[model samples]
Each structure stands twice: as C-alpha cells, then as structure tokens.
Target: MTPLGTAVTAGTERAWIEFRRGFTNATDLGFYVVMSVVVFAILWFNRDTVVQVPGYELPSATYALPSFVGGLIAFLSVLGVAYALAMEREDGTLLRAKSLPHGMTGYVVGQVLRTTLETIAGLTLALVPAMLFIDGILVDGVGGLVWLPAILVLGLLATLPIGVVIGAVVRSVRQVNTWGSLPLFALIWASGIFVPTIALPQWARVVGQLFPVYWLGLGTRAVLLPDEAAALEIGGSWRPGWTVAVLVAWAVAGVLVAVPILKRMAARESGSAIAERRERALQRTY
Candidate 1:
C-alpha cells in the first residue's frame, strides 16, 4: 500500500483496539451505565406530561427526548475530543505519535473513529430504551426510512471536527472541564434542548440558532415530531436545506481550521515537553 493508505489502515486498526478497550474498561463501562440511567430518568419523568406546542399536542417527554439525543451528539463530539486529547497529551501519547513517520495522521484518524464509536455506544444506551418505552419516536415510517439517518450523519460530520479543534487547543484536562463543559452546557440550555426556541426571547433564540447544537436538535425533531410540531420551530417548516447548509458549513470550516492548528500543536510535542507535563501532573498528585 501507499504511505497514505498504510497510515489510514493503521489508524483504522488502532480505532478498533481502542473501541474494544473502552467497552471493557470498568470505569468507562460504569460511566456509560450511569449516563444511561440519567437519560432514562429524564425520559421517565416527562413521559406523561403533554406539552402543548403552539399547534400540536404530544407527550412532553417525547418532544424533549429526541432533541436531547441530538444535543448529546454535539456534546459528546466536542467534550470527548477535548478530554481525550488533553489526557493523552499529559500521558505522553501524542509525544509518542510524534516519533513515528505519518503517526499524527494515524493518531487523528483513530481518535475520530474512537469518539464516533464511543458516542454511538452511549447513544444506544438511551436510544434503545427510548424506542421501547416512548410513544412518539418515529420507528417505522418515511422518517425512519430517510430523514433520521441523514440528520444523524450530518450532525456527526458537522460536530466532530469542531471537537477536534477544541481538543487540539486546550492546554490541560482540567481546562477541558472548565472551558469546554461550561460553554457546552450553556449552549445546550440556550439551544432549546429542554424547551422550544420559540419560547426564548427573540435575541436569545437568535443566538441559539447561530450554533450547530440548535440545528442538530431542530433536525432531530423534524425527523421524529409530527408536522404540527414544526409550528414550534422557527420558520414553521423542517427547513432541511438550511439544516444541511449550516452543518456542512461548520464541517468545512472546522476542517479548514483544525488542520493548521493540529499541525502546530503536534510540532510543539517533544520528549522534554512530555516529561515536564508528566512531572507537573505527578507533583499535583503528590
């Protein structure tokens, strides 16, 4: 195989290994279980309440559930990348990669796969239960046939690169918690995850619409919610064109920006730098 092909193949293999390791790790498995329980509680608590969206009537849980799922994708994509990069940097994983020819390519590809698979694993925990118990999720219809998969794929493409950029820029794992988690939570709240964007003040709603999280939530709702639910959305339509356009725009922009940043970050990685970080981390632990 050519050098590029060899790197990609190695990356793919590394991703599989990481995926298996992630599922087997006790801490990681427990985290997934806890998240599943949390998501189930959210679904169960809201199941019986019928939310009166301006022109529609549906179980409030049904309305909130899918949007929450969509928002989770963005959250996982960004926070996962950020935390993984930061932790690996501290542990000298990136420095090791810097030692091999074309290793950075493999490292990045493995990360993309790892984050995607891990997020899917987490999603399944909530999604399987939601489908079995919830009433309004579109399991078998035109929606199930088409829009559901399309929106999911688009959502991943749009959000994953942005996550990588955040991961590349963060200086430490703690900063990921502070800088990454705080803004993401704020976005989730502002993006109408728990309520309709239409209900937010005009400016707040507009601010929410500016980001991919709101569009992801909106697209998921479009796939699952009935036509009348569109009444609660801006523009009173699914606006598939806009959804695709916005996500694609972010995807393109993220890739364009992440490449240079990642190269710069990788260039700075060295044995001495890794040792310094390790020493600092060890000192903190002591």
Candidate 2:
C-alpha cells in the first residue's frame, strides 16, 4: 500500500475502535431490539385498519416493512453521524485526528461505514417481525428477492452524502438536533410515507418533488408494490423511471457538495483554537 493508503487504513482502524466504544456506550443494540418489538406490535394492531383503505391491497407485511424501516434508518443514521461530527469538533478529537496521516479521509470513511452498518442492522431487525406477523410481505418472485439487497445498498449510498454534509456544517449538537428535526419531518411528510403524494395539495406536491425523499419513496414503492399498484398515479403521472433517475441525481449532487465542505471543516478544526475556546468557556462559568 502507498503511505497515504496505509495511513488511511490505520486511521480507519482507530475510528472503528472509537465507533464501537460509542455504539456500545449508547446501548444502541438494546434500542434496536426494543424498537423492533414495538414496531411489530404497532403493525400488528393496525393491520386490519391499514387494509381497510379502498383500492389499496398489499402483498405481505414483510415486503412493506423494509421501506418503512429503511426510511427511519436513513434519517437516524444521518442525524447520528452529524451529532458525532459536532461532538468531535467540540472535544478537539477531530483536530487530533487531523495531525495523523490520511486522518481526515479515513475518519470520514470509517464514520460512514459504521453508520451504514448500523442502519442495515436496524432495518434487518425491523424486517424479521414484518415477516413473522405480516403475511405475504416477502418478495413475491425469486427475481425480486435477488434484487432486493442491491436496491437497498443503492438506497443507502443515496443517503450517505447527505449525512456527511449535515455532519460537516452543523456547528453544535443543539443546532444539529433542532435544525435536523425539521428536514426529517419535512422529508417524511413529503415522501408519501403516511399519505400518498397524490393526496397532497398541489403546492406540497411541487415542493416534495424537489427532495430525494419523494424519489426514494417512489422507488421503494415500485420495488415492493405490485405493478398495478405501482401504476397508481402520483404528482399527476406515475413513472418509476423518473423516480430512480431523480434519486440517483440527488445522491450524486449530495456527494459533490459534501466532499469539499468536509475538507473545509477539517482545515478549520485547529486543536489549539478549540482548547482555547474551552478554556474561555470554563473561565466564564467560574
């Protein structure tokens, strides 16, 4: 390996160690376990009500579960990574990492990888209950099953750069939490997660189309629902091809914007400056 590659690898290893420590410390595993049970319970209790909608026939709960879980995973994963970045900035840890070889790229890669793994695990846990309780939810044909993982990976890739950008720009944990919640809610609402985009007002539909969430939901619905169901109209006319293209475009655009921002953030994160700020804060408190 080239020296840069070696340094990147070593930095990735260190980042992984830190990630594991934080993951365990946060007891995220336990959170996922409890959440899975709760989500299944909700689905079970509401299945009859959910099926009552006219002209809305679903295959199995298992097939429907992944998109819901995936949406949630995407939101939380991005928020978590952003929060981590803000904390690292405050703690001077990011500055320390910068002093190491290939530290910036390796640290960024490790965070993205760790966050992606967490999202996958959470989504998988969500699917188990969906399979057990929601009948006819699994992929209908062998073809769908074979392609499911590939689609999911693409979906994950689509969300990663947005997460990185959120992480890079937010100045504080409080700001991240407050501002982040707005987009999360907006995306979920606009994406037709609870209500079909067709049902939304014209202005809302116009606004929703500008975001990746709409495309993500549209692509997911195309994959999970029957062709006839997918044929249902949205934002005037329904087109799966347009949905896929839009989502891919969003993902590409997000990456293009995030990389330079991350580099800029890294350049600005000086250990001495962070330490001085902390000292001043401490003095003011005393």
Candidate 3:
C-alpha cells in the first residue's frame, strides 16, 4: 500500500480503538450517563412551560430545544476536545505519538473522529428522545432533517480546530478547565442558548454574535423552527447563507492556525519535558 494509504488505515484503526476505549472507561461512561440524565431532566421540566413565540403555536421549548442541542454541540467540540488533549499531553500521550512514524497524523485523525462521533452520540442520547416525545420541538419536518445534520457537521468543523489550538497552547490539564471550559460556559450563556437574541440588550447581542456559539444556535433554530419563528431572531431572518459563510471561514482560519501550532507543540514534546510534567504532578499530589 502507498504510505498515505497506510497512514489512513492506521488512523482509522486508532480512531476506532480510542472510541471504544473511551466509551468503556468507567469514568467516561459514568459522565456520559450522568450528563444524559441531566439533559433529559432539563427538557422534562421545561416541557410543560409554554413561551409566546411569534407565529408559533407551540411552547417555548420549541426554540429552547434546538438552542440547547446546538450549545451542547459547541461545548463538546471545543472544551471536550481541549480537555482530552491537555490530559493526554500531561500524561505523555503526545510524547508517545511523537516517537512513532507519522504518529501525529494518525493521532489527529483519531481525535477528529473521536470528537465527531462523541458529539453525535451526545445528540442521540439527549436530543433524539426529546424530539420523539416532546410536542412542537421540531416543526420544520423534512427540511429540518436535512439541514440540521449539515449545520451540525459544519459547526463541528468550525469549533473543533479551535479546541486543537487551545490544547496545543495550554500548559497543563488543570488549565484546560480554567482557560477552555470556563470561557465556553460563558459563551453559551451569552450566546442566547437559553434566551432569544431579540431579548438581549443590543450590545450584549452583538457581543454574543461575535462567537460561533450564537451562530450555531441560530442555525439550529433556523432548521428546526417555522419560517415565521425567524421573526423572533435578530435581523428577523434565519440568515442561513451567512451562517454557513461564517462557520466555513472559521473552519478555514482555524485549520491554518492549528496546523502550525500543533506542529510546534509536537516538536517540543521531548522525554525530559514529559518527565518534568510527571514530577510536577507527583509533587502536587503529595
């Protein structure tokens, strides 16, 4: 086989192995189960409360549901990947990757596949049941079925590389929560995940719009809600074209930045550096 083909085959195997290991790990499994329950509980509590959305006969959960799903997509793509990368780096996983032929290539491919599948799994666990049981959540029917998956894939591309860059730059696993996860929660809150952009102050809405979280939520809403529901959105339209444009731009820019940054990070992964990190971790533990 060609060297490229060999690498692709190795990467695919690595991705599958990693995915299986992750799902089977006790901690990871527990976290998934707990998060699934939390998500369903939130949806259940909100199921009965109806909000007045213009041109929509259903409750507010119709809008909230898509936004919630979109927010989870953004969170998983960014903070989830970043946390995993940081932990791997501290534990010498990156160093091991650097030692093998074309290991970085395979590792990156595995990571991308892992995170993408994880995001889809999250949606399946949390959002699919809501759509099936809840009334008025997905009113756009066949069109939504097509566009929702498209936007989700685009959202993953746009946000996943940002996480890669963050992981390459973060100093330690502990720092991921501080610099990556915390700020993501802040973005989710401001991005109109739980509220309409129209209800936010003008400046606040502008600030939210600067990030991908808002756009992801907006795109999801566009796919799931009725046309008249666009009246509730800022600019009174879904702006699907602009959503795709911005997400694509982010994906391109993030790839350009992440490649160089990841290269540098990989280059710096020496045995001594890994030992020092291990020593520091031991010291903190004792």
> Tens-digit lDDT track for model 1 on 1-286?
8877777888899899988998999998998898888888988888888878665688988888889888889888888888888888878898887677788998899888888898888899867787688887774487566878888888888888777777788877888877888988888888889888788879878888888888899989988887788878887787888988998888888889988988899899888887888788789899
Q: What ranges in model 1 sit over 4 Å off?
A: 139-144
Superposed on all Cα atoms, the candidates' RMSDs to the truth, in angstroms, are: 1.5, 3.1, 1.7
RMSD score of candidate 1 (Å):
1.5
Q: Mark the regions of model 2 whose C-alpha exceeds 4 Å error after superposition.
A: 11-23, 51-56, 59-66, 231-238, 276-286
Order of the predicted models by TM-score, top scorer first: 1, 3, 2
Question: Residue 106 of candidate 3: its Cα lDDT?
Answer: 74
Question: Cα RMSD for candidate 3?
Answer: 1.7
lDDT by residue (1-286, candidate 2, tens digit) is: 9868976787567657765765576576678777778778766766664322246565434333544754665675777678778778888878877887777777777777777766766777766656666654445688667556555666666777777787778766667866676787777776666555666777877887787666666666665665555534373344756766776787788788988998898898886778776886678679
Give the worst 10-residue stretch by lDDT in candidate 1.
Answer: 136-145
lDDT of 3 by residue, 11-122 (tens): 7887788778878899987877787788778878887777666655556667688898889999888977798789889888888877777788878887888898888887
Rate residue 92 of model 3 by lDDT.
84
- What is the lDDT of every predicted structure here? 0.84, 0.68, 0.83
The window of 10 residues in a row where model 2 has the poorest summed lDDT is 51-60
